[model samples]
Target: MRSSTIRRALAAASTVSMLALSVSACSEDTANDSTVDFGYIGDYNGVSLLAIAKKLGLWKEVGLTAKVKAFNDGPIQVQALRAGNLDFGYIGPGAMWLPASGKAKVVAVNTLAYADRVIAQPGITSMKDLKGKKVGVPEGTSGDMALNLALEKAGMTAKDVQKVPMAPATIVSAFSSGRIDGAGIWYPLIDTIKAKVPDLEEVASTRETDSSFPTAFVAGNKVKPELTSKVIKVLQKANDWRARHPREAITESARMLELDESKVKADAANVETLPTADLVAKTKDGTVDKWLNVLGDFFVRNGQLESAPDPSSYYTGDLYTKAYAK
Candidate 1:
């Protein structure tokens, strides 16, 4: 009787062990099929892959759902990221300082040669003409950096101009009503500004001075690598779709952002988003590292940082490789 009782207890223990293992497997699978929150600027001015991914339902197709948030600028996005309110954000090179200052990590490259322009009134045809004028700029942005470079090249400084702090969207109305003499902004808003001011002149732009600017997908240090890798995979798919269907991409972006399709097209013309292969290659080949270093050096010179941080400390191409290999 005693031997039979002992056998029954052992059998029951084995059964419970098997049941727990099955439940653990199911939970692991469920974790793999979860939602991710993403953030980006609320305009068509930069690499808007998050919008494309949201429009195409690519995140769902990849076994993940995206909760997308649109921010007015990079600084707001940076705050959300640091507070753990976001799982990922697509930030422009202007805000690359986030990573350099140890606030975030760049996991993948979004676009190359992402440039901004300085638009002035008809008579303000040169950078020197910006002196003593009320110039609207989204400070601490790529446009602001571009304006600085142009000013430096022209032997001028931000002090030379009366800096009017404003966003690109606001720049439109202020500039149109003559509240501001000039604006340092990105496209398709550049075209929109021109429409409002018919004689707006392109005084300077990154197309000539700062061509190495590249936007990136950044995440907080605590975010899981697997999540970023999955996001990059979705981005790769969205980028390919955009490259293959340029007109549709523009229309969809405009519709999503609630902007005019014509303006979106004009903005698209000024930007070059890298194809998947090239993007993957660049990340793997240390090109992204070089670009981030250039961005860091710019901030240092602008008095934002004492020195540039080593790229490896804040950037990693491993995620790109892992996602692509999958």
Candidate 2:
């Protein structure tokens, strides 16, 4: 066989073997019933709410044996969900646009407000100052996309600056060595980097942006849509817990994420946790549709997508409505 053909055959064989192994490990009961495997981009503050959900057994209470896994970033997490390795995960608006166009359906908007920021060395005041300066970003992540958006808002692009693609964990070392002028990342790392550099300045925050960026709970398109209701229920329970017991939620999340309580509290405050009912109403009323269309258009105008897909099909408010109605 041709080399390309041989490689394709090997990949197919590997996939089959993995599927067979997964099937073999399933009990008769579990073989028929569905299980949801949730994925998220790693970083204590980014997934602090998820940590609280898991710690409080919210998923179990909602009839899901939720297997939450950590990924490097949103792009990777979405890819895993697309491949059937994960049932659901959180994804930023940018990453969600691409997959939602394909076969991934967003079930609920996790957060609407921007909860991220672009932090740079003290002396770097603006995107213009970042020109010719090395910047570290978790490539293909929401953070990287956010950085691109910041640059665009400042009338620049990635080509206007030196780009260094690194994982979030390694950004601190890169910053300390003076190898990077800035790092676009989320909290906890933002907190850590600030402590290490003391004089680091935030150039932009999601809070200041004009867009309502939607980070969502997504599931594979092929999965039974009914399971989405279970996922929404779990999320609703978690959100309700947050409102009723903010301190306990913060404490449990901090312990689970191994971060200081104050940082966790700060991160929690930044998140706009929505109940499934509100999300369903908002989505049905075209709130999320409007945002997704705007974001899609932004990507297309900037040449991100070949053509924009219909935002309506990208999300279904049905699951949220059903889950929250109960």
Candidate 3:
């Protein structure tokens, strides 16, 4: 994944993933049918499973069609879902928390572990050392959540340092140019930063956090109770194919994200594909509950939410276990 920035450049030479997608193919004619309108966080490696599924034709095999939409971040996905837009969505805790606070339900969590990380210079051995330093993050997004989570763990807060809201690419540049002391980001952007500054290294990761803040699929008003099983089956089918065809999976994902194949291949290795049943079991044991609690607390502590939503009312893993049962 080293030196893996998309050199091809986007429509405006932007390094961020392009937001436009061809939705005309899954047009109105199929909208009234079983074609599920799905949304995904654009080209992000951790949540790219659904993108791979769409490319592999996994939806149609089970008598379903998927209308895929791409968004730059989770907040956008949350907005569409809340307005009765999608049946299911792939998002991180950043946006997932909003829908969960409203009418959304998390049916499944994939990629229990993530490489979206907090990296700092070698001198900063601990999170506390970041105090008073300039830290780059895509503020009000999952990047900030990961960064805040790290800070909270170190008995610190966003106020402890200067928070710079910038794109991941910009953050990488800032860090390299000594404008920012550290950054909270994910691959392949993180890969680019590391490639340029070998001395910079990861100090915290969502994977090591007490709760697993996995990228999850949230169902909204468009999802009927009976359709939950079918929706997840498509994801499982995609996961099955991904395991069988790792090369094809990465190649297709690279095409979708418009990233370098080598970088996608490297990013793919850092992603975790978990079974739906395992997620259900984890939820039952209060793992997901704890994560939501921690997330809600973070929001309230940071004044992002007036009140934390109830976990029982919105979050459930029961749907996942029931989906696979004969």
Give the Å shift of residue 304 in candidate 1.
Answer: 1.5
Q: Residue 77 of model 2: what lDDT?
A: 63
What is the C-alpha local distance difference test score of each model?
Answer: 0.69, 0.64, 0.65
lDDT of 3 by residue, 1-326 (tens): 00112211121113323232232333334444466677665443433666666676666655566666655455555667778776677666655557556757777666653656788876886778888988898665667777888887888888998888886556767887878887877655666677678888687877776565666777875577667777777676666666677788778777776666776677666566665565567777887777777778778876777788777767655666666564
Worst 10 residues of 3 by lDDT: 1-10
Residues 1-326 of candidate 2: C-alpha lDDT, one tens digit per residue? 00000001111101111111011122334543356677654333335457667766665565556555655456666677778788877666557655646758877777654556777888888878888888898765556766878888898988888888886667766776677898777664566566678888788776777777777767787778667876777677776776677788778765654556776676556666665567677877888788788777777755667787887677777667677778
Clashing pairs in 3: none
Candidate 1, residue 287: the lDDT equals: 79
Give the CA lDDT, 0 to 100, for residue 10 in model 2: 11
Ranking by lDDT: 1, 3, 2
Candidate 1 vs candidate 2: the lDDT winner is: 1
Give me the candidate number with maximum TM-score: 1
Candidate 3, 159: how far from true, in Å? Answer: 1.4
lDDT of 3: 0.65
Ranking by TM-score: 1, 2, 3
